[model samples]
Every structure is written in C-alpha cells, then in structure tokens.
Target: MKRFEGKTVLVTGGAQGIGAAMAKAFAAAGAGVVIGDIGDAAGQAVQAEIAALGGESLYLHLDVSSEADWQAAIGLTLEHRGRLDVLVNNAGLGPAPAPIEQCTVQAWDRIMAVNARGVFLGTRHAIAPMRAGGGGSIVNVSSIAALGLGALMEVAYAASKGAVRTLTKVIAAQYAREGIRCNSVHPGPIDGGMLHGVWSDPTKLERRLSRIPMGRLGRMDEVVAAVMFLASDESSYTTGTELTIDGGAAVQ
Candidate 1:
C-alpha cells in the first residue's frame, strides 16, 4: 500500500537486521531511502539491493552517537532529495549482562550514547527540516526491555532504551501541534545475531517465552512493519505512545 509514496526516509543502522528490513520496506512503498550506518560495505550493499528492486536510495556513513554526523546526514538528505519525511532512529548496541554495580561507567556511557543520545540527535535535526516541509514522522526503535524487569543480559542497554522511550514522549507532545508525529516501537528478543548469547539455551528461551503470550521471539519484519506504520500517515493520530511490537511480551 503506497503509504509512503513520494516521501524521503532516513534510517539509522540501516546496514542490516531490522534496520535493513525497514529501509527496504519504506523504499518498496515508494519512499526514497537513505541508509545511514557505520558499516559502509553493508550499507552500500543494501542500497544496491534496493536499487535492484527499482527503489530510489543512497547510502551514507552515520555514527548516530555523534551530533555532527546527524546534522550532516540530514543536511545531505535534504540538500539532495529536498526533504526528509521520516527519521528512523535505529542505531544501537547491547552491553553484556551486568548488575548496576558491575556496569562500568564506560560501558554504560557507550550504550547510552548510541541507544539514547542517538535518538535525541536524530530527532533534533529532523524537526526543523520536517517543519520547513510542513511536517514528518519520527520513529525511534526502543526495546521491550524498557517495559519490564531487567533480563539476564544488558542492564545498561535496558536503561538506555528506557531513556529513548521517555524521550519519544517529550518530542511527540512538543511537536504534536506542529504537525510532527513521534513514536517508539519496542521489540522483544528479536532473532538477530546480536541477541544470540543473551538468551542462550532452551531453558533461557523457555523463560523468555513464558512471559510472552505469543511464545516466540519477534521477527525483524514484524518490527519493520510497526516502524513503517509509525513512519507513515497511516498512524497520523498516534503520538507520544510506545507501541510494543513484542508478541505480547509486555502484556505479562
């Protein structure tokens, strides 16, 4: 359904996994896409694949953790395509499991930089360009970890994502009257390589499943769909809300 037809989208972490899927999905729906990732090789490859599918796109190196990078990327997208209709703040990294006491200051800072501060920087740059173009959508990729007890892994990651969740609300409320919509999607235990050791063993899986009524890990495509909805006019009435695309994990 050409929901994003003729729009221009910027997806951070668009090199692979959920971000890659979201980039292709947006392009398929007729939006010109810009893939922003530190992984230059993978980002270019994804852009090539999208082009093969008859989609318009460009690939750029974006370190979301850097404010200057965010500014330059948005500036380039607008300077090249005229505007950015959607901003998907998808770049992030998960730290190893640790209690509050065990989390090194450096480790916590790194996770917060990418997961939380990245969203802030992306949204900051997107608003003005979007305002100039009449308005746009901002979708931040948060984690279901923000909604519950800290799992066996990544305490710092969870905290960082939680910050993103709250940050989304503030932006949404502040921009609602300005025609800018901001939302966050929470994913549960996606089957990406990044999640491998976090839920190690069948027992760990079972414990994880027990909390989710759907009884299975979330797929990257599922997360992409939710992000797409939030990114497009399809969810125009939605703002400041946390949409959990976690297969009922947050329900329990």
Candidate 2:
C-alpha cells in the first residue's frame, strides 16, 4: 500500500515552489491533499497535476497569516477529506536580503506575520481535528537562516524562521500525549524557486556554495523526503526535534 493511503494532508503556500512539490508528493503517496495558498491559479494548477497523476487533491484559497482563512481551510479539509492527518506549515515570506539596520519595521512585521504567526495559527487550528482523529503530524518548514547561517543576508526573515523553529518544539511538547508529532525542517539555499535569484547569479551562487561542505545548493525533493519521513508513521517516535537539510552549511 502507498505510504499515505487514506490520510489527508494540508499544505500551506502550496501554490508553487516547495509547497507545491510537497502537495504533489503527499497526494502521489496516496494522501488526499489540500493545496492552500493565496495564488489561486498556481494552486489550481497543482491540484490538476495531482489529479492527472491519479492522486486526490483540491485547492483552497488560504492566506496563512489570517486566522479566518485557517478556520475555513481546516473546515473544508474535514468536510471533504474526512479527517486531517498532517499539517505542513510551508508558507513563508522572504524579503530582499537586508541587514537588521536596514530592515524596515514594515518588513519585519510583514515577515513575522506570514512566517511566524502563520505557522502558529496553522498549528493551533490543526490540533483539534488532529486530536479528534486520534493523532497527526505537523511539519514546519523553517530555514538555515534561523540557525544564524543566513542571518547576515536577511535578518527579519531569519528571525521569523527562528520563531518557527521554537514554536515547533512547543507544539511537539504540548501535544505529544495526544499523539501529535511536531517537527521543523531547516533548509539552506535551495537551488530553485524562492532562492533562484541567489543561484542565478554567479557571484552569489559561488559564495553560497563555498559556505557549504557539499558545495551545492539543496534540492526540493531532498526537503520533501525529509518532511515525508516526519509526517509518516516511520517517525512515530520522533517529536519536538529539528532536521537540518543544509548540505553541511550549518556545520561550517
């Protein structure tokens, strides 16, 4: 049987990038997936692709920062998929790289709202259905920035992700007794999507690669596999921990 057969996964910011990738992977693994994102077109396209793959999925218009959106999204997930088995807090904001001094208040607030508060809201709302269903897993997509590796480039973004990292631990600890598992995945300069601009530039790309012992940026599938592990029964004993997928960047 497929790994996620009969399970339901809700992926936030699943319209594109790593979010879309995770949604497709979960559905292909046999989970009924909910693609939650503000980008309606891209989100629907991902849902369609999953359908073509013979996977079950639906797109939901969700602004992760909004509690109202979270309520509606979760409501729809239960109404359609029957139960919530996993919640992937994959939506986040990456502002242009700026030091703390240059990072405007507006940028900080916006980043925190989407990256930090959004994860908080998603986790908070998902707990009930997950508990009602007997158990669930929540995988928050943090960043190597949260570990101080990328802070020099984006202070606000790093701070926001730091919040995600700790928040994940809190959730894991409080919900373990209820059979809920919570973990965070920290990824370094991924090769495409949000980090494409960095990889697209020769100077920046070389600089990033030089910092990593692996000498290459991470891949989307690499991160996806890690998340799948955490969300699956394979990680039944794991909770309140972090898995870093940074190609040794954190060690350097």
Candidate 3:
C-alpha cells in the first residue's frame, strides 16, 4: 500500500516506541520519512531500518520543547525533501503517576513542555511549508486522559493531552480553508514500556486490564494504522476530529 508515494512525513520522537513504529510504517507505505528526535543512535537505527526496507529516510536531532530545534528540524526537512506533506507530533513525556499534592511544579512544567508545547511548535512550523505545497495533514498523538476516560493518575499529563486535543481542533478549523487537516488520536493502555510498572505488578496489570473491555493492551501497530489513515488522502473530508484507539476502555 504505497499510499504515501511521493509524500514526505516528519515524525517527532521517532527514536522509539510508537513514534518509531509510525516512522517505519510510513516508510513502508512509500513516504520519504524524516525521523526527528534527540536520541541520535535509536533515531539513526530506525532510519537505517527504513532504508533496509527500500525506503528513503533522514534522521535529525530534535528537541520538541526547543523552539530552535523545531525551526532547525523544519528547515532540514524542507532542504532535504523539498516539501513536507505530513507532520506527526508524536514526541511526548509521561511521568510516573503522582497525585497533585506529590507532583512538583518542575515535573508538571516538564511534561507540558514536551507533550503540549511540542505539538504546538511542530504544528506552527509545519503550516507554512504545507500551505505552500497545497496543504497537508497533522496528526497529534493525544491520550484518553484528554477525554477524561483514563484513570487520571497524572493531572499534568492529562492537562497536557487536553491542550493537545483542543489545539488540534483549533488548527483544523483555522487551516481548513488552506487545505490543511488536523486531527488527534487518543490511545489507552498500549502494550509498551509506558506502562512498565503496571506490567511488572500482577495486581496492577489485572486492574488495568479489567478497565478495558477488550481485556488487553493495545499494540503499537494499532496506533500506527490509525495515524496512517488520518495522514493519508483517504481521510480527505476528515478534520478537527479524534480517533480513539482504546480497545473499548473509554466506554467502560
């Protein structure tokens, strides 16, 4: 499915986890992939893997919270790919669950910087290039916490993701006339290192699984597929919307 043939996609936090999965999937779909992350070794490894799959890719050092890094990433993408067709604001920081009383201001600020502000910077910079190239898609990786459908264990993380959800809608509304589409994905209890603590503890794992109606954690590939759909042309009419990949967790 070479749906992204001739397109170029820039994925922030493409060094590992869901971001890495999305990068590889996009490359397999025929997009020239640009992996933006501070983790040089892992990012380069993902890039190499894409190359091995017979796809074109580039790796760039990016700190999502840094304005300078955002500018450099966007510039590098344009310089290398000549145009940007998709932007996935996937870089995020999830801190250990701490109640509001126990959570420090520094921890809150740090989470907001990466999860919320990072999406802002990426979307802000990607607009011009996309607008110039006849517009593009922006997929913001939010979480079920934004919708008040999670355990609400981390207030700051929930707040940050809520901001992402709102920002995505606003961008979609503001740029629709220009042909730019913005949407968000809300994932719940994905089977990744994000929940290592819960995975290692039997009681915690059982409790977590009990909440999801499907009784299982989501796979990284599931989230990747949702992002791919939102980024692809098949979703031409979709914007300002959110696709939740929570395995019925949100319902229960």
Candidate 4:
C-alpha cells in the first residue's frame, strides 16, 4: 500500500512556494490533501492541478493569522475527510529586508501575527482532534533566520520564526505520549517564490549564494521531501526536533 493511502493532510499557505509543493507531495503519496491559503484563485489552481494528477484535494480560503479561519479550515477538513492525519504549518510572511532600527512597528506586528502567532493557533486547535484520533504529525516551516544565520536585516522575520521553533519543541514535549508528533523544518535561501522577491538584485543574490557551501539555492522539492518524511510513519520515532535543509549554509 502507498505510505499515506489512508491519511489526510492539511497544508497552510499551500497556494504557492514550499507549501504548494508539500500539498502536491502529500496527495501524490496517496493522502487526501487540503490546500489552505488567502489566495483563493491560486489555491483553487493548486487543487485543480492535484485533481489533474488523479489526486484528491480541496481548497479553502484561509488567512493563517485569523483564529476564525483556522477553526473553519480544520472544521472543513474533519467534515470532508473525517480525520486529519497531518498538519503542515507552512504559512508565513517574509517582510522586505530592513534593519531592526528601521523596521516599523506595523511590519513587526504583521510578521509576528502570520509567522509566529499563526503557528500557535494552528497547533492549539489541531492537537485536540489529533489526540482524539489517536495520533498526528505537525511539520512547522520555520527559517534559517531563526538560527541567526540570515542577513543582518530581517530582524522581525527572524524573531517570529524563533517563536515557531520553540513552539514546535513545546508541542512535541507536551503531546508525545499521546502519539502526536511535532517538528520544525528550517530552510535557507530557497530558490524562486519568496526568495525571488528577497534577492531581486543580481548582486545581492550572488552574495547570498556565496554564503552557502553548496554554491546554490536550495530547491522546493528538497524541502518538501524533508517535510514528507516528518509527516509519514517513517519518522515515527522523531519529534521535537529541528530539521535544517539549508545547503550547508547554517554550518558556515
């Protein structure tokens, strides 16, 4: 049987980028997939793509920062699939690079709401259902920024991710005995999508690339594979851990 033949996964911010990749991957692995994102059009497009691939999926309008949206999304998933086997807290915001001193309070709050608070809310709600069902896995998409390995700028983004990192550990420790597993994935300088906007300048892009010992930006599929492992039974023994997929950048 396929690894996830009887599973269901909900991927937040799944309309694009790594979140989209995770949604596709889970469906391909034989899970019923749910794509949650604020971008209705893009989210529907992803749902269509999964359908075309003969995968079962649904798209839900979700603003990760809102408690109502989280409740609704989870409610819909349980209504449709009966049980949620995995939750990917992949929604996040990467503000334009700015020094801490120059960062506005609004920008800081916005980042925290989406990046940090969103994870908290998702985890808070997902746990009860998971426990009732006997088990579940939560794969949180954090960042290399949380490790203090990002550019000198991005203070707010870094702080927000740091919250996600700690929160992952707390959830894992609190719920391990209940069969619920929680882990965080930290990726660095992923190519395309969000990074395209961050590294729009050729010189800046090259400078960023130079920092990675791999001499290139990481691929979305690479990160998706890590998330898939964490989500599957293959990682049954793993929890409360941080998996860094940074192309050796974090080491240097």
Candidate 5:
C-alpha cells in the first residue's frame, strides 16, 4: 500500500533483528529509510538488500549511548533525506542474565545506558527535526519485561525497559501539543542473535516457551508490524501507550 510514501524514517539498531525488520518493512511500504546502527557491516548489508528491492535507504553508524553519535546521525539524516517523519529507538543490549544481587554497578549502568539512556537521547534529539517538519512519530522498542517480570532472570533488562516505558509517556505527554506522538513497543521472546546468548540452551528455551500462552516465540516481522503502526499515522490517536506483541505471554 506504500503507506509511507514520501516519508523518511530513521531507525536505531537497524542492522539486524527487530530493527532490521522495521527498516525493511518501512522501506517496502515506501518510506525512505535511514538504518542507524553500530553494526556497520550489517547495516550496509540491509541497505543494499533494500536498494535491490527498489527501496530508498542509507546506513549510518550510530552508537545510541553516545550523544555525539546521536547528533551526527541526526545531522546525517537531515543531510541525506531532507526531513525525518519517524524515529524508532530500537538499539539495546541484554547483559548476561543475572539476579539483582549479582548485578554489578557496571552491568546496571551498561543496561541503563543502552536500553534507557539511548531512548532518552534519541527522543530528545528527534524532537527538533520532527517539530521542524510540523510533526512526527517516535517509537521506542521496550520489552515485555517492562510490563513486569514476565518470568525471572531479567532484572537488569526489566529495569532498563521499564524506564523506557515511562520515558515514552513523559515524551508523549510533553510533546503532544507539538504534533509529536511517542509510544513504546514491548515484544516477547523474539528469536535472533539478540536472543541467542540468553536462550541458547534447550532447557532455557523450553522453560520460556512453557510460560507463553501461545507456546511460541515472537517473530521479528510481527514486532516490526506493531512498530510500524505506532510509527505511522494509523496510530494517530495512540500515544503514551505500550503496544505489547507478546503472544499473551505478558499476561501470563
């Protein structure tokens, strides 16, 4: 349907997994895409794939935890696309799962820096260009753990994503008057490199699957579909709300 014709969308962590999925979806639906990620090679690969499909795209190096990188990325997007219609903050890191007792200051800081601070910085910098364009949408990729301990062993991840969820509301409420929409997406157990280090063992995988009501893991495209909705005008009336793509697992 070419839902995003003439619109330029910027996606963080666009190199692979959920972020890559969103980039592909937005480009396929006719949005000019800017794939921002630390994964330079993967980002370029995705950009190339998009171009092959006749989609407009560019891959820019973006380290979400760094303000300098954020500024440079925003500048590059403006220079390349002229204007940005949507911003998706999807970059994050999941440290080796550990209980709060074992959570060192470094681990906590790292998680907060990427999962929480990254979103904060992304929205702050995005507001300027978006407001200049008359308005825009901001979508933060949170996690089901933010809804509350969906299971266990995710203390740090939960704390960080929880901050993301609240930060989203703060942005939504503050910028609603400026024609900007801010929302968060909480997806559960998505299979990919991102989920690899955590659920690599059969025991862990089965243990997680047993709790999900749907008895299956989430797909990258599924999460991307939700993200696209929140990123597009289709979610015109939605803001400060979290769209959970957890196959009912968040509820269980």
Candidate 6:
C-alpha cells in the first residue's frame, strides 16, 4: 500500500511556493489534501492541478491569522475527510526587510499575527481532532531567520519564526504520549514567493547566494521532502525537533 493511502493532510498557505509543493507531494503519496490559503483563485488552481493528477483535494479560503478561519478550516476538513492525519502550518509572511528602528508597529503586528499567532491557533484546533483519530503529525514551516542567520533587517519576521520553533517543541513535549508529533522545518533562500521580495535585486541575490556553501538557492522539492518525512510514519520516532534544509548555510 502507498505510505499515505488512508491519510488526510491539510497544508496552509498552500496556494504557492513551498506550501504548494507540499500539498502536491502529500497528494502524490496517496493522501487526501486540503489546501488553505487567502488566495482563492490560486488555491482553486492548485486543487485543480491535484485533481488533474488524480489526487483528491479541497481548496478553502483561509486567513491564517484569524481564529474563526482556523476553526472553519479545520471543521471543513473533518466534515469532508472525517479525520486529519497531518497538519502543515506552512502559512507565513516576511515583511520587506527593515532595521528594527525603522520597522513600523503595524508591520510588526501583522507579521506576528500571521507568522506566530496563526501557528498557535492551527495547532490548538488540530490537537483535539488528532487525538481523537489516534494520532497526527504537525510540520511547521519556520525559516532560517529563526536561527539568527542573515535576518539582520527582518527583526519581526525572525522573532515570529522563533515563536513557531518554540511552539513546536512545546506541543511535541505536551502531546507525545498521546501519539501526536510536532516539529519545525527551516529553509533558506528558496527560489520563489517569499524569496522573491528579498532577492529581486540581482546584486543582492548573488551576494546571498555566495554565503551558502552549496552555492545555490534551495529547491522547493528539497524542503518538501523533509516535511514529507516528518509527516509520515517513517518519522514515527521523531518529534520536537528542528530540521534545517538550508544548504549548509546554517553552519556558517
């Protein structure tokens, strides 16, 4: 049987980038996938792509920062799939890099709401269903910024991801006996979406690339592979861990 033949997964911010890659990977692994994102059109497009590949999927409108949205999204998943086998808290935002002194209060709040609060709410609601279903895995998409790497100007973004990192560990420690597993994945300089804003300038892009020992940006598939491992039974013994897919940048 396929590894995830009887499983169901929900991936937030799944309309594009690494989240989208994860949705597709889980579906291909034989899981029913629910994709949540604020971009209705893009979300639906992903749903269609999955359908075309003979995968079952649902697209839901989700503003990850909102408690109501989290409740509704989880409800919809349970209603359709009966159980949630995995939850990928992949929804996050990286504001334009600005020094702490120049960052606005509003920007800070917005970043925290989506990057940090969203993970908290998603985890809060997922636990009960997961426990009810016997067990589940949560793979949070944090960033290299959380490790204090190359995030000098992104104070708020870095801090928000730090919250996610700690939150994953706490959840794992609290629920391990109950069969629930939680972990975080950190990627550096991925080639799309979030990285686009930071690497738009050719000079900056090259400069950033120079620091990675691998001498390149990470591919979405590389990160998705790590997430898939954490989500599957293959990682049954793993929890409360941070998996860095940063092309050796973290070592530097």
Every model's TM-score: 0.95, 0.98, 0.97, 0.97, 0.96, 0.97
lDDT for model 6, please.
Answer: 0.93
Index of the highest-TM-score prediction: 2
Predicted structure 3, TM vs. truth:
0.97
Residue 71 C-alpha lDDT in model 2: 96
Model 4: per-residue Cα lDDT over 1-252, one tens digit each: 887898989999999988898889899889999899999999999999999999999999989999999999899999999998899999998756778788899999999999999999999989988988899999999988888765554889999999999999999999999999999999988887687775778898888888889988899999999999999999999999999999998898
lDDT of each: 0.88, 0.92, 0.93, 0.91, 0.90, 0.93
> Model 5, which residues run further than 4 Å from truth?
197-200
Which is the better candidate, 2 or 6, if ranked by TM-score? 2
* Candidates 1 and 4, the one with greater lDDT: 4
Q: Report the lDDT of model 5 for residue 169.
A: 96
lDDT by residue for model 2 (1-252), tens: 999999999999999999999999999899999999999999999999999989999999999999999999999998998799999999998757766788888888999999999999999999999999999999999998888765355888888999999999999999999999999999988877787877788998887788899999899999999999999999999999999999998999
Q: Looking at candidate 3, what is the lDDT of residue 22?
A: 96
Q: What clash pairs does model 1 have?
A: none
lDDT of 6 by residue, 83-137 (tens): 9999999999875678888889999999999999999999999999999999999
Error of 5 at 31 (Å): 0.7
Clashing pairs in 5: none
Prediction 2 global C-alpha lDDT: 0.92
Cα lDDT for residue 252, candidate 1: 72
The positional error of residue 185 in candidate 3, measured at the CA in angstroms, is 0.1
